[model samples]
Target: MILEYSNGLHVGGDSVKAEEIPNSKDRKYYILARLVDGEHLSYQRLSNDYFISRSSIAHDVELIKALLAKDNVSLGFDNSGTFISGGEIVKQKVIKRIVTDLLRAADDRSSILKLFIDSSSITRVEEIFQKQVQSWQLEVPEYYIDDIVISTAIVVDRGLLGHHIADAKGNQLGSLLFQFDKYPLVYELIKGVEEAGVYSFTPDELRYLSYIVIGNGFKFFMKDLQIPASFKSKVKLLISTVSDGLNIDLTQDTRLHADLTVHLYQMFLRLQAGTTVINPLLDEIQENYPQLYGTVWYAFSDFGSDNHIAISDDEVGFLTIHFQAAVERTKSAKRVLFVCPNGIGTSSLVSAKIHRILPEVSLIEVVSQVDLVRQDLSDVALIISTVQLPAQTVPVANISPMITTHDMKTIMNRYIDVSMDGSEQEVDFSHIHSIPFLAKDHVLFCNAKSRTAIIDSLMAMNEWPNAEQRNMFRQTVFQRDTVQSTYLDNGFVISHGDPSLVSHSCIGVAILDKSIDWMSNRADVVALLMIKKEDRKSVEPFMNVIMNGINNKDWFISRMMEISEHD
Candidate 1:
């Protein structure tokens, strides 16, 4: 029989009977009392905890809920997250179900007797016979009594009377008939034996006993007889008894792998009860069998928590310090160069102008076109020039003769700066004077007339004796008009290339005595052209440094433009 529990009692039999209800009443009452005492019970939770079906628990709860509602006693859940309603009542009902079922199983014998008898009348006869049957009058040998009890139980529980009739030797029943008749005699033999005692059995031995007594013909006969309601319970009891007798060492058997332990435990609970007994068995295996312990431990090792910590504070700190040093080094240095067409005079004039405007920066000596072609110009940052030099040389800043002091300041301040204070310093322009002739490759000096006229005159000369070169030079000078000589809002333009294509390397100077309308803006300034060759790769590095230096407001460009007109 599949036994279920509500309290301490088993709730099932071959057929459920009304007489078993009172046995479960105490549990039901206790459940009601607990509900009144403020404990909540959920049908699903109880079902899972008890290994019974939710439907069964729900039925029991419904009965309790209905009974409690009858007395105008309202059961309700509280806002404190507890089911204060019918907990005690429900728990009592569950207990009642268990107790009642247990008593029903213990008292009912008709259901047990019908297993051996086909006719219902035999059930009554068995009951009467049981009452009149003589109890053991004296002590008997344990083995003999055990044998008699087992045989009598089988006959009485299985209704073996139905199996008794004429055999093949039909004269009169012989030894087999006597054996059947003597079942009561065996019953009397063991009537006084204690109900509870410990026994053991191996699984194999239990299997053999089950096959011998319950398999094949016996199974068919029991089914045919429409046996007692309690016949299933008796069968279960017999099988359990046989299993206990076998005493199998289930723990050491590898056939019972750990993965199947839960399933095996559940099966055991269905057949018997209690899991506490399995603990000692497990401990014994763990101690005696190292291999099993190792395997199980290794299998579950991934689930173990790891608590290792890794540290790298020193390495990270060192890397951060090194990077900061590199950045600071780059931020402090500035370099520049000025270039023109000849080694004569204009280069010196422009170089002087640059130095006066930006005193903080170190300026390289001005070089003429020929000198620039001959020298290694790799380190130069800015090349101020009137002519287009070789590509891949340096960054160039181009300008016209009209460049003024304000224009120079604007160009330098917009593109380059040099200061260690980390605060912006403006370019100053107060001490500047007119030199008679600033000479390097070409001559440059302040005059009442335009400097462009002198440049045009120089290009027309044939004193160098290269006719084609002179013509080319003249064309190059004229082409400067293509830049429109217009002063933009921030600076002035004085070149032929597209403003967009011209690199910012060229420092354009604007020389103005008074504001004059040159294009749309007012200006009459000297623009120092800082133009590099169009194809210089090293130009970017130069531009980065010079632009940063000149972009500061306090720098050289303003100082150069502040030169006195009278000197």
Candidate 2:
């Protein structure tokens, strides 16, 4: 084996090098790790161990003090020597952070983990944890399980060394202690560790461990876990916000609902405990799925600020996977368009009949064959037709005007075919050339510095006949924006208001002179999409254009700006 340094590579054979001192940077980390592990420290004693002067130890302590100050932690000294001044939980957070920073990219984490426990001890803890998880059929994200194993190992190591996490203070997490019995995985894992007789735990210590269980994605069984109504409401709001923003339907996606409910609950508990898992695929998720990632990020702005925890990009990356999967699951979300050659009376009657029988389909469009050619079929998942006079790309279900039970079954089967079709659809660039509301006065520039300012500037440009309607439109859009922002990944925003409140469908575009903070992200371009209640389907063209702008930001925005400047 050989070791490489700035000077040169030194061919070497493994032997005792006890006299060789670790560099100052490595030495400081070792000292800090020992401090985090509840070790006694003093300049005199430290100098004895390192064979260094007391002033040299004092210099190291100053650097350590600066690092601790980042977390509002400080060092206190007395006649007995030096000690950490933060609470017990804070120390655990430091330990967990150290472990995370070490294990983020390491193939073998046992080296840094040895700061808390030996290699053999870590192995023992992992065996105990894995057995409990398998024996109890406990489901947890593998990322979180690794953190739990390290945390449990640290607890055992500290306990064996005559140091225990103090828990005599009134417990802030007592409410969760009861869940250990409800969630047997918690009890079984802790019991398994105890049975080994490696470390006995007190009542307070058990309570702390119980919290560790609940916070580390142990609430895997969603049906058995008791979720607060408020959390359920928030989840519903999240789905609705994303649905409205993307112009798609996900309200009936039970899989998305179930998975998000479980994931978010555990995420909240983990955040409250100050423990976080790193995502190795965060950059890839952010880059590949920019639109979905941005939607999820903006959707979580209020939720995070309200809870006072900045939702890290890694957490957002984890959540984007669930939403992206739901998107694929719902791609063939059938948008049945019932067309009849007859007038409005007959077409409406037949379409209403189809909807009445298939109550599961929330949206059904009633259109005449004459109007079918004018419709935007980019988002139409399936079409039900009474007249088939031409060949087209979209799959059509031919049925009589007086729809029967057999017709309903046929439509259902066709919907299944469309839903399961994995063939990809190309981006709809046909509508980008003729995007609506591109007049010079409509595509106005603004010098706003905030979300509220930009929204106000854009709203004032809308062609409202009266103040009452304008105020109503403004209030609805404002309230929805409060619930979930409409910012996109590439610094573009697509905010909309109640379509019924508008007399006509038109877009008000805002081009910011500079980027403004929009919720948790930034935005330099804003589009106010206002549609009439009857023109809901027409919004597809506008969405395609917005997506093109997000995906091809430089060219799209520059062209739009040039057109705006010349128009």
Worst 10 residues of 1 by lDDT: 302-311
Worst 10 residues of 2 by lDDT: 1-10
In model 2, the Cα lDDT at residue 205 comes to 63
Q: Give all TM-scores, in the order shown.
A: 0.17, 0.51
**Top model by lDDT, which number?**
2
Q: Model 1 over residues 1-567: C-alpha lDDT tens digits?
A: 111222232332233344433233333443443453345666554454334577865555555544433221234544432243332223222222232233245565333222222233323333432343334233333322222223223323222322111111222212322242333332222222212211122232222222222211222212232333453333233222222222222233232232132222222221111000112123233333322222222111111111011111111122222222333343434456565555456666766777777776674566666767776655555666556666745556665433467647643753363232332233122312322111122222233234454334333221323666445544543444321222222222222222223233333233334433332233333333322333222222222222232333234234343432233
Tally clashing residue pairs in candidate 1. 104
lDDT tens digits, residue span 406-504, model 2: 887888788778765533345565445456555555676768887777777777766888999988988877666554445555788777766678996
Report the lDDT of model 1 for residue 457: 38
